[model samples]
Target: MAGHPLKKIQCESIARTSGKQCRAKGYLKKSGHYRCRFHGGASTGAITLEGKLIAYKNLKQFKNYTDEQLLIWIQNKLQKSSSV
Candidate 1:
């Protein structure tokens, strides 16, 4: 309730084709994955991108959350209704 919730399309879990676009239902389980099992959801890894545009985009979306916050966020069914 402390921050603004994100606005996006809710991925249709039933459709399968566009399921990844779902609002915040979130993917199946794994340590570091957020997408469904079909979309590399069980991978543990990180890659560094080299681009100011991409960097800014990431920063803007994740500016309020930390590594720890992300873990908690994911645990709570990817809920964006509250602050991360």
Candidate 2:
């Protein structure tokens, strides 16, 4: 029996914990990159202003900024979006 042809394309991403190449099979992306499901294979990122704001607020480092600072950042992002 032959192995799955897709198995030949291993993920090229390095694991954050082990710092080694990921061994999972990777899916080819429109951006010409290969990433396994565990490594953002389906992530398209925040595409809208509201989505970006939500993503920013959910960042791990959000604790470092005060509410006023966060509001200022959001306002700035809104301005940029409006300008674009």
TM-scores for all predictions: 0.22, 0.45
Return the number of clashes found in candidate 2. Answer: 0
lDDT of each: 0.46, 0.78
Please, what are the lDDT tens digits per residue for candidate 1 over residues 11-57? 33443566445445345354443543444445443333223333444
lDDT value for candidate 1? Answer: 0.46
RMSD (Cα, Å) of candidate 2? 6.3
Q: Which stretches of candidate 2 lie over 4 Å from their true place?
A: 1-7, 45-84
Model 2 CA lDDT for position 17: 92
By TM-score, the best candidate is 2
Q: Which pairs clash in model 2?
A: none
lDDT of 2 by residue, 1-84 (tens): 257865479778999999999988788877787888898548768777567667787788876876667778888867898999
